[model samples]
Structure formats: structure tokens, C-alpha cells
Target: MLSSWLLVACGPSQEPPENSSLTLLHPNNPSSDTETYQTENDFDLLVSDYESTQRVIWQKPDLVIAQLGDLSGKTVADIGAGTGYFAFRLVPRAERVIAIDIDQRFINFMDSIKVRLPENVQDRFETRLGKPEDPLLKPSEADVVMLVNTYCFLENRIQYLKTLATGMKNEGELLIIDFKKNNLPVGPPTELKVSTAQVKAELEQAGFKVKKTDNQSLDYQYIIVATLQKPTNKIN
Candidate 1:
């Protein structure tokens, strides 16, 4: 057993709605950011859904893919994969894409969409309900682990990073794309934004070595490619 502290950003209670498919959860992952975000009811109306047009301009998904290097025959875990925004892009390139979200609603939404997608696309992707602390993925199973705009919201992020590496292969990479600390036209509140240097320092403390960083790849955010400083060093 990893830990019982898994949870969403502002997650569901220990027991989700009686009708919910989410039976594996504990509490919300605590964070120091004081800003507020969406709720369960908000998701029902697709409030969490990303805007494709804006994403094309701001996130530049295509550029992000190019930066990731080769994905052929790779296994990627898209942590906090809201509505499988990036997972859809990964499934076509990677051998497998495991979409994990603490919100079961997101997983269910992905399931609904997955059913309508082509069989080949469906075969390349999977959805798993995750806890805030644990991604619930097998040990050393992924070649690439990614998080897009998901880092600032996690509680005990340092601990989560320590736990996150367990799911990556010895030489695997961890990619994070998040909002910059500066004020932006579109993004989370300023207080919630985390600087790239801050993330780098935190990851370094958690036993990850920052390999590359690109500030211009995304309009309002930055990307970091880090490799696990392997040899199986676990943080106490």
C-alpha cells in the first residue's frame, strides 16, 4: 500500500455520491494556494473542459509534442488528465496512455468519450481514478509521465513527486507544463501560479534532475523535462 492521502485538488469526500463510480478516494489534496476552482456540479456542465481554439494558441499542443521527443511505443501517464485533454494527443503517438485524475467524473467523462472514439484509439488509452497522494500506477511502468497545469494544485507536491517516480522506468522522463508566476490574460489566479525556478528547486529536492526547460514553447506557461535521478533513492 502506498498511502491513503490521495485526493483531487478540491476533491470529493471519502465516499463519493452514492451513484458515483468513484469508490477509491480519501480527501482533497491540500495546497497553500488560496484561490478557488471548480466543483463537481461545475463538471456536469463541462466547466472543466479545455477550449480547443484557445489551447491551439496558448498551449500549442503540437509544439509540446515535438518537444517531448519520440513517443513511439512509449507508455505515458497523464496525471490530472482533465477530460483527457492531452491524453487524446498521446494515444495517437504513444503505445499506451494511462489517464489518471482524482476526480472520477473526469475519468467517467473520458470513458464516455472513449466509447465513441475509434476502436484503435480506444485500445491505446485507459482511465484510472487516482488519489491525491498516489497515481495508483504500477512500479516502473511508464516511459513518460506528464502533468499539464496540474502541479500548482497538488497538496504535499514534494511527497507526490517522490511517489510519482515509482511509476516511471529507470531512465524515464517526467514532463510538467504549468502557468507562469506572472499575471496572464488567461490562467489560474496570480497567487496560485508557480514559477519555473520554484518547480525546479522542488523537483531537485525530490530527487529529480531538470534536464530541459522551455519558456517560449507555451504562451502563458512553461515546460520542464526532468529525469528521475535513479538508483532507487526514496525520500524519507
Candidate 2:
């Protein structure tokens, strides 16, 4: 159930003890302001059709890669990595590309795709089935974790991040790319769209230090790069 919680987000009243173990909380449903993820046909259309305005003008997948320079030997966790869109492109440069999605079908599809690739290329990629709150990442492992058009799908946003932080390296970067709230011709309904400022605040509240904000990179969406606050110090 999405209601299951493994950890809680940081706050003046919700601050977790330093020795606490990680937790992931999943709400019974998505937030009222947001729409749910696509099922059957919608999922097919979304992943197969990449020629939409979001891709051509925005050049989204490529644009994100270009901004994060020199991914060689780095580990990238592509959260909500549907159809292995960014995961396939990242494997060549990244030492390990972990493609995470809540959908088993997506993971199955990526697995089938990998079966046809050369042996060397197959070794660089992996697919993980992630839950709404828990991505099931190994603690202190990834170098970079990115979510493209995936942030808003989360129901318990802040608490989810707290658990996600456990899966990353101290200096790891967290990237988020999502639609702007300006009534774009396409994308999730305006009411479901989260503003960049709101996104930044949520991340900061969850202990991420916002490093860069680029609103011009995409015509419809903006990108924010924030590093997880090290435990004094601090995953998927």
C-alpha cells in the first residue's frame, strides 16, 4: 500500500534523529492537485511518441544530458525512466545507469530491450522496480539521481525525498525537470503543475542544497540541480 512509510522528511517538528534508519512512505493515492500516472494506452502513447512539442522544441532528453557535463564513469539513477529513454543514452558514458520506475511493465520493456543489446552495453544498464515512496536504492551509492517529468507524480513529496537521500553519495546531485505552470499547450493540467520556486523550496526543506536553476533550457519545463545535504551528513 502507498500508505506504508519508511522514513519522514526533515522539519522543525519532524526532524529525525541522527542514528535513525531510512524509511519510505507511500500514500494511498496521489495528491489531489496532481493527476495519476498513465495506465495502458496512455503509457504506450507517452513512451512511443517522442515527436511532441516537448521533445522537438525542448529537445528534453538531450538537453538534460548536455547540462550535466562529463557523465563518464558516473552513476546515474533515472527515476521514472519510462521505456529507458534517458537510460539507454546514459549507459555509454555512465559506469552504471539505473533505470527506476514504479511500473513493472516499464521494467519488463527495458529488460526486453537490453536482451538485444551487445554484451558490453548490457553490463552498463540495470532496471529497478520502484514504489511510489521507496525507490529501493542502496545507501550512499549513486553519484547523480535525476527525475524528468517525474517529480509531480509523488504523493508524499517531502518524506519521499528524505528516504531517497539515503541512496546517494554525499556529494551526489539530484536533478528535477518538470513542466512550468504557465498553461502550456501540452503536459499535465495546469492545476497539477508545480512551480519551480515551490519545487526548490520542497527540495530545500528535504535537505537538498539547490545549486542551479535553469528556466531557459526547455520551452515548457525548467531544470533544477540540487545536491543532497551530507550528513553534517547524509540514496534512491
Question: On residues 106-208, what C-alpha lDDT tens digit does candidate 2 reach at each position?
Answer: 7898999999999988988999999888888998878999888778778688889888999998979998988788866445557767899999999998999
The CA lDDT of each predicted structure is 0.73, 0.71
In terms of lDDT, model 2 sits at: 0.71
Show where candidate 2 strays beyond 4 Å: 1-42, 50-54, 233-236
Candidate 1, lDDT over the whole model: 0.73
11-69 per-residue lDDT for model 1 (tens digits): 32232334332211112434312221222243432322252333465577888877778
Decoy 1 TM-score against native: 0.80
TM-score of each: 0.80, 0.79
